[model samples]
Target: MALIGIISRELGNLTFLVSLDLGSNKFHGNLPQEMANLHRLKVLDLSFNSFSGEVPSWFGFLHQLQALNLGNNSFTGSIPSSFYNMPKLETLNLKFNSIEGQIPKVIGSLINLRVLNLIGNKLVGFIPTSLSNASRLETLEISYN
Candidate 1:
């Protein structure tokens, strides 16, 4: 059977973790805030699960995060502004969720970002012009909102 239930707070004990992919599983519930302790994390994929609640803003603390995939889940609420603080972030995927509100202009601050996918959300408003500031951005998919 697929892994199910909330992630344990004990996961934060792995301070040396570099990558964690719990995607395409049946796991549900809010992400444990304790995960903020994973200071060395680089890749985190929690897609295609039943996870519900506002996307955690503490993700900004993961300074080493390069790729983040929280797509195909049940998250709701506007995109967290803290996400713009992750300087090393390259890929951000939040497709097929219940996220709402306009894409913040601060998103352009992720100078190293390469791929950004936001398809199938409840977002509204024109794509921000400041997105042009992300000079390194290569792929942008924001259709089907």
Candidate 2:
């Protein structure tokens, strides 16, 4: 596995909005929590890797985040409740992983959410009611085991 530079912080000031495409790479390890510092980030794609560990709890602070894709990895743990604070989230893709736990109730607060994909995971329980609160929700896919 390769160790890549974490450039998330440099983009926090609006000089740049972070976007990562390390998908289909040989990179393996827990995702760095420093990524949460990318407050000005808009898009983040970290799919198709062997990355493991729980999703960072600080993600809720990303008020400017739009698209977030963390699919096809070895990640484990419950979806962070802090994510409910994401103010501009639009699309979220997190399929094919070991993520487990009930969908957060705060997810419904995301009035701008369009697509939320949580397929092929260990997560259990029926979809939460908060999902229905999404006035702009186009799709809510959760294939829990």
Which model scores highest in TM-score? 1
lDDT of 1 by residue, 48-68 (tens): 999999999999899899999
Off by over 4 Å in 1: none
Q: By how many angstroms RMSD does model 2 differ from the true structure?
A: 3.0
Candidate lDDT (C-alpha), each: 0.94, 0.79
Q: Give me the runs in candidate 2 sitting further than 4 Å from their true place.
A: 1-15
What's the C-alpha lDDT at position 55 in model 1?
Answer: 90
Q: Candidate 1's error at 51, in angstroms?
A: 0.6
lDDT of 2 by residue, 33-134 (tens): 566667677888878777788987888877888888888988799989888888789998889989998888888888899999999999887778877889
TM-score result, candidate 1: 0.97
Q: Residue 96 of candidate 1: its Cα lDDT?
A: 98
CA displacement after TM-score superposition, residue 32 of candidate 1 (Å): 0.9
